[model samples]
Target: MLKKYSATPYVIWSILFIVIPLILIVTYSLSTKNPINGQLVFSFSNYRKFLELKFINVLLKSVTLAFKATIICIILGYPMAMILSKMEAKLQKKLIVLFILPMWMNFLMRTYAWMVILGKNGFINKLLSMVGLNLNLLYTRGAVLLGMVYNFLPFMVLPIFTVLLKIDNNYIEAAEDLGADKLTVFRKIIFPLSMPGLISGITMVFMPAVSTFVISNLLGGGKEVLIGNLIEQQFLVLNNWNFGSALSVILMIFILVFMAFINKFDKDNDDKGGVGLW
Candidate 1:
């Protein structure tokens, strides 16, 4: 009875939301354009078009940008997580709030805020002018990267911080009592224990950063077109739902494969150390 009830909601929700929509998308991707009727008919041509060199280039660029952003988040967020973990409970709570406050505001509003700060003749440029310096830093690859990092940093920090908080202070004290230095204690004890958080942080940051559209759009000023932008154009602007569906499928598969690989790595690590991925 318990099993039947549990399975019923799962089946209904999956069919209503995930399965139904995905089936429709796949159907669309396999369909051909009927100019006479303005409807799609069954064919494999859309997926073939996705393999064109120009399309491939756009997908690669998006992947590159996402990967770079994820790396930067790890580099900056890990140390911040460590510091937060080591702080007094009151201070740690305040810092966590500060990290999360940006997320409470609307996402586009935050992106627009960055635009005001980073645009030509914007706040930062004005400050630089005060110091007798001139800079034009907008609409570049660097701006897009900065936008991605700013938007996604909280995702990375929260997961890593949660993981670090789970680690007991006694382990660090134990290492120190054994005459281990700070670096040694961290490398040998703290870092290993925080692996779960690190994995969670990587997944949290990488997926959204990879597929994020609005940040790359408004901040990139249409000059930088990532895969998300390409997909958006196909679906919304060009009225080529078939091609857009194929692109969406490809991106979904890419994320699934990447996550599968990460899960396998976690499993291997777990068998070796008895660590759980939280």
Candidate 2:
């Protein structure tokens, strides 16, 4: 009876949410525009338009920004995770709360806060002017990158911290017992052990960074458009639902391909065994 109930809910959800919408999106993608009535006609021109240079440029820009954000998160988050893992229990809990507190605030509110700090007349610029320095941050690509990093840092940190905590301390002790230096232990043992978390954190940061349009629009000052922006424009401004749907399909396909690549490359490791280093 329990098994039947669980399976029934899954079937209902799949049909109502996932499967049905996917079918509609696919159907929409393989469609064209009707000049006479300004309606979507059943054809393939939408996909053809999606394959054009302008849309391709937007996709490329989005992917590049996402990659940059993921790298920044790894560089910054790994150290923070390491510090948190090494601290005392009371301090660790406090720090973890501090790290996650920002996420509790509304995302748009946090983003707007950054705008206040980085805008021409904002905090940073005002401080610089007081000291005879000047900087232009608002409506720039750098501002967009900063916003992505600020927003996604918690997602990157939480997964990595979880993995770090699960690591066997015996490994570090054994490495030291065998005269292995701290760097050696970290390079050979700790890093490899944290691969799953690292992979997951990368996915968490990359996917949203690439798909986010609001940050690019508000921080990037409409100059740094991404694939998401293009899709939104297609749907709203151009009134081309078919083209927007096609672009969404392409974006989903791209994410699926990247996930497949990560899974394929990381398939060799099995972390069930708890062997200490050295």
Top TM-score model? 2
Over the stretch 39-154, how does candidate 2's per-residue lDDT look in tens digits? 76788777777676557878888999999999999999999989999999999999888888888899999999998999778899888998898898899889999999999988
lDDT per residue as tens, model 1, 96-117: 8888888899999988998999
Residue 168 lDDT, candidate 2, scale 0-100: 86
RMSD of 1: 1.9
RMSD after CA superposition, every candidate: 1.9, 2.8
lDDT of each: 0.85, 0.86
Worst 10 residues of 1 by lDDT: 269-278
CA deviation > 4 Å runs, candidate 1: 2-7, 274-277
